[model samples]
Target: MANNQENTSEKKKSEKKSEKKADKKQPNKIAKWFKDLRIEFKKVVWPSKKTVINNTSVVLAVVAGAAILVGLLDTGFLALMRLIYQ
Candidate 1:
């Protein structure tokens, strides 16, 4: 009986210690998270104005090419449908 009571008290003490440790770290964890995010954002190398303009032009060209290709395919498909349905 005494051994069981001692074990229960010991368990309670350890749990309280764990709770205190977690309470102490709560603010530190948030501060550390923000610090890490700031560091990661600083590490990013943003594109220059010239590079951005060149990339934009390339994207626009690709979109135009795809649009033309799709239009042609659609016209051919419509012709084929008309032939079969008529």
Candidate 2:
């Protein structure tokens, strides 16, 4: 009878442990995602305002240059095609 009581208690303890593990496994995903996002954002190194503005200007300039180059190429190709068809 004592051994049966011990076995029942051991089974209950194991059941409690498994419950705890199951609870841990079912974490609130949204809370976990926000927690991970906060941790990652904390790790980021932000640039200075002047550096950001300078980089932004550089990007705009490059984009404008690329647009102009593409426009010129398209116009030249259109003119060449017109001459060939005429």
Candidate 3:
């Protein structure tokens, strides 16, 4: 019975030590994460102004073309329906 009591006391001491170590490490972990994020952002490649403008114009042209095509199809369908009903 005495040996069992000693063993339980030793386990409790070790658990408290581990909990203190974990508390100290929490701030270090957050600092390391922010440091890694800054390094990763430095490695990123950004697009140039000319390249961005070219891609934007291409997207706008395609959208305008699609809109015109849909409008034409809608008008043709409406005319056909009118003729059939008359």
Report model 2's TM-score to 2 decimal places: 0.64
lDDT of each: 1.00, 0.96, 0.99
Q: Candidate 2 lDDT, tens digit per residue, 4-85?
A: 9999999999999999988886777667998999999999999999999999999999999999999999999999999999
Clashing pairs in 1: none
Model 1 lowest lDDT segment of ten: 20-29
Candidate 3 displacement at residue 15 in angstroms: 1.4
Candidate 2 whole-model C-alpha lDDT, 0 to 1: 0.96
> Which candidate would rank higher by TM-score, 1 or 3?
1
TM-score for candidate 3, please give it: 0.70
- lDDT for 59 in candidate 2 is 100
Better of 1 and 2 by TM-score: 1
lDDT of 1 by residue, 1-86 (tens): 99999999999999999999999999999999999999999999999999999999999999999999999999999999999999
Ranking by TM-score: 1, 3, 2
* Model 3 C-alpha lDDT per residue in residues 24-69, reported as the tens digit of each score: 9999999999999999999999899999999999999999999999
